[model samples]
Target: MPFTIDNTILLFSLLLFIGVFTTKFSARFGLPSLVFFIAVGMVLSKFIYYDNAALTQLFGIMALIVILFEGGLQTKWRNVREVMVPSLSLATLGVVLTTLVIGVSAKFILDVSWLEGMLFGAIVGSTDAAAVFAVLGNKNIKQRLTSTLEVESGTNDPMAVFLTVSFIQLIQSPNANIFTLILSFFWQMGLGLALGLLLGKIAVWCINKINLDSSGLYPVLAMAFAIFTYSSTSLLKGSGLLAVYMMALWVGNSDLTFRHSIFRFNEGFAWMMQILMFILLGLLVFPAELVQITWQGIALSVLLMFVARPIGVFISTMLMKFTAKEKALISWAGLRGAVPIVLATYPLLAGMENGHLFFNVVFFVVLSSALIQGATISPLAHALGLSQGKKSVVPHTLELVSMGKTNHEIVEVHVDEHSGADGKELRQLKMPQDSLVNAIIREQKMITPRGNTRLQAGDTLYVLARKGQNEEIKALFHQQVTEQDSANV
Candidate 1:
């Protein structure tokens, strides 16, 4: 068949369908589904010979915006806040340390120039959230450890991007001073954070005020807002990725109409984004080129997986008070993914010598990380005593909300020991009309509370109530004991 638009569409559809199927199959075998997605893309690229490299790159960029935004939305302030200092320090200083260590090691081991070594280090320094989240989700692990990893993955991208671009520019202009580089780094990250906050707030205000009849369209609008935030921030010489991610995190945790539906949509969207990013990255590779560089690539991948990562983790987490097991697990969990490959593209785009070699090397590193690190994550977690016991099977909760409707209600209720509802069946609580307990978190265990489930003291209940009735519901639940009732008692 001729390579036309129709043919391209059919090919993409087939790949996507097969990709989903392969992901399911991979999961059944206890392998990382992402590896399968990339494998599928590689197979297809060899067979079909798709020629739209530019389009693939564009799609990869778009996918990043979605992935980062979804990540942001899913992030909770409470979880991040608890580990803010350490997480931030790791993302910023730890990334710098990792890059320097790897760069210096690469210079000595691989005989590359300092700038080239730094580029290699920067490209591989940041952990990929897509890989980390996919592995960590639904796994039994301590909340603090999981949160620390999640927060690190989500926040560390900008630093990697900064270092990568900085080295790229330094290589291009060998005379650039250290002071100029430091100032530029500060400016980019600072501006990105500011723009993200501003844009996120505006988006939230717009979402709350706009009256849209179709609830399904709200997610699309939110996505547009996210993309716009990213683009505007990038245009202003800021880290658009950071801005969009921070904005999404803020908005996701905020009080917005159709909040549940938006989150649900974004979750699926993010997964799709991850799949597409990996596939595009896979397609960007030339199998012939990879074969030629295989040995060197393998060596660097090994150095990164074993030497660079462990040393960086050890030094960074030293004196941080994490248990020995926790520290070991943290060291093992630095799985690389699409970010390095994407960052590698910067050098290629800059027409730098050895750019293709760098890309292939980074690709091999990611593949190895996914294979070794991803495959053994659960086992390592278990060995390190970080695994949560056998998982409990709980039915998932589906939350649907109407958008642009101020009549909807969001309520928070804290369970107390003396409350009459404690230890009583959910059905017996006589909760206000049109109210449902969406989530009940007790001792850090998240439960989808059912009608027959008994409420426990110290549980945090997220109750979704009907609009205009929240005040009445709160009054009913928070009723004080009357003097007459005491006298009768």
Candidate 2:
């Protein structure tokens, strides 16, 4: 059978369908969706040959841009603000520390040259945003711990990219000064940070002011600027990944036109990017080649999980307010995914002596991390007494798409079994003057909220209220603490 453009489209569509469908099993089996996505690619690898490292590398970059931007957009600023200092510390210094430990340890364990070992360490140094976000999606851990890990994963890529590129240069030129490279790192980071913030503020202003003919154009405009931010920063010798992430963070947190619509669109787009990236990486692997690196990969994975990551977390978070348990969970949650495999392609693209070896080893390590650490995060959290249990699933969802700047937003308030407002009629409750119940969701059915309607336990209220009324609204609906509850606390 001759493979034509039609055939390519058909295959691509089928892969995407399977990838999306794989999430059901992920939820049912308590594994990360990425694990299933990659597995599907590997299972089909024999039939579909994909050995283009350069093309894979390009796709990886595009995917990461969308993923990071969407992640930043969805994250709340208040959550990130409290842990910014520690998160940045872990994202920068912690990455460096992890790389150093793994590099030094690999020199002896893998019996490789100093440069090669360091190169390997740099490849897998940063925790993957896709993996972290996917695993931690609904796992109700402590807010501080979650924020720290999320911010760290979202921000650490630039350091890994820098270290990987610098080491590749050192390997090619052997006489390059380490001091000069270290200085270049600072220059790149500083410029990236400045450009990201500048462009982000400008982007937000433009978004708020521009009135396009079609509302759909808003998201399109945002997407174009996001890519431009990365390219423009990179062309000027800055950290493109960091610029993209910071830019999205600023834009996402700002009050802009159709903010909810833009967020929803970007989120779906990010999922497609994730599926494409993992499947492509999965197809790149050959089972025959991976067998050769099994022992080496396992050894390095153990070292990274147990030694390198812990040391990095402890050292980076020292003097901070995190407990030992919090730090331990953070260390264990550093699961590598597409980013490390993407970095592995660097040596291959550069045509290094051990290019193939580098790619295979890194691929094995990533698979191991995703399979082991990724699968066990929830159980480990529970055992450490840090798990808050899974979040209650709401059958219905509500979103407020703003047409223009407004102070009103939709908030979901859940009624507990014996909450303050559980048995009260909607008219009897003391709601803020500006607040209105949009709808009541109970037992997976939507109810038109009337003044005489009584609020039942387990009902989810979608209330449209002005921004400042949340505290009063929550207080009215929140379950009051009784003597028994106080005793339990």
Candidate 3:
């Protein structure tokens, strides 16, 4: 049936209502809301049919672009750098290893042809950042592990997609040369990276240069720009997913105006995309096909979870100086998600033989990974001794506003030992220029500083630093600590 305005509005309204309530319901039941979203989609599919596959596919792709961009925007460069080497290795080499392992195992054990087996492997190889981000957000996990998983998921899709598409091409055209395949892969990834960075920089310039009256609308404009970047890159034969993610990350980490509102908007939008994507995928599957694929799918999933994933993790982290426990956790945390199911649709759309089985198998794999890895993350962290009790809270940014002839600025800083103000007289430690020691809270007691007032360890001191001197003052304090640590050593 042709899509009518009423149908569009009604479907969207139902989706939004399901998205909101399922989140709360999932939380209450200790279940992943993605499961509920998929279930909802399945239920809707029975009653309301969309006869147009192209429209459904377009929606899925568009949703993925939005989801990837939002994930990129949330990625912190600081966090990415901490696990850069391992994360890169995991995303690239690990994906290759996983694909090869699953491919080989499927070909030999499941008696599938080489190309078909590899296709199956390639489809399931990439981890879903949307799933990982949704599950791990606001959860207390070790920074390094969390960062590694998040970074890997965020960056791995390009490589996985390249492999999947490359294999698909090879399967369709068996006469294609190896050199051609290699060149195409490099071209796609390189162009995608370049385009993403270029577009992101351009968008940043535009956002900062264009002074808009309504700050609230800036985020919406920014989101539109992000989508445009992805679409343009993909049209140019580049990886749209890669470009969108990189651009989002750049915008997110930059000093954009209305940063808080932008993040909030993206966060909600991302969740909505995820819910819609999972539901659409679930609706695409038939329960009978899912059952037929179950036995072999379960076998492949075991090989993926227990064999392929661990080997991939080992190869990626072997050179790194991680503890045994850390390695174990990393190996176990390779969670499959919506990406596999999405990729499975490709083969089915192409009318490949046994494509229904492929989709069903991919669905089962995603479910198993989410159920096992998602549930055990916290326990695994605790077992590895990587769970830092509660995250130490720190305020890193402060807002400043001004009125005629007076200015008010909020200051934020961390309480670290060896700070000049630590275990010493606040007066004795020379204050930076144009700064006032405003408030000090030590062990829940707010005390006003006097000339003889001594600062203690664990005291959070809020200083009213002068406008435009905040950076200099912070530098001075940090410099004092470096010198103190050197003296002690």
Top model number, lDDT: 2
What TM-score, over all chains together, does every model reach?
A: 0.85, 0.92, 0.82
**Tens-digit per-residue lDDT, 319-369, candidate 3:** 997888887888777777877877777777777785767777888888878
Which residues of candidate 3, in runs, are more than 4 Å off? 1-11, 28-30, 50-53, 108-110, 392-489
C-alpha local distance difference test of each model: 0.78, 0.86, 0.77
> Which 10-residue window in model 3 sums to the lowest lDDT?
397-406
Off by over 4 Å in 2: 392-402, 405-421, 465-489
Tens digit per residue, CA lDDT, model 2, 1-489: 567999989988998999899988888888888888888878878888889999999999999999988888877788999999999999988999999999998788778899889999999999999888888878988878888899999999999999999999998999999999989999899998899889999899988788687777888888888899999999999999899988998997776666666887898999999998999998998878989888988899899999999999999999899889999999999889989999999999999888888888888888889888988888999999998775653222234554444667776788866466668799987788978999999999999999999988889898887764655677665434243255557
* Prediction-by-prediction clash tally: 2, 0, 0
Q: For candidate 1, what is the TM-score?
A: 0.85
Sorted by TM-score (best first), the order is 2, 1, 3
Q: How does model 3 fare in lDDT? A: 0.77
Give me candidate 3's TM-score against the actual structure: 0.82
Candidate 1, lDDT over the whole model:
0.78
Candidate 1 residue runs with Cα over 4 Å from true position: 50-54, 390-403, 409-424, 427-489
Write the residue-wise lDDT of candidate 1 on 1-489 in tens digits. Answer: 798999989977877787678777767776777798888778767866654545665676788788778878877788888877667777887788879878887676656899899989999999987887788777777778887888888778899998998898899999989898888788889998898888899989988788787888888999999999988988888888888878987897676777767878988988877877787777777677778777777777787777777777777777687877887788788778877878888888788897877887888889888988888878888877788775433222233454254465566667665456667788877677778788888899998888898887777777776655555655555562232245558
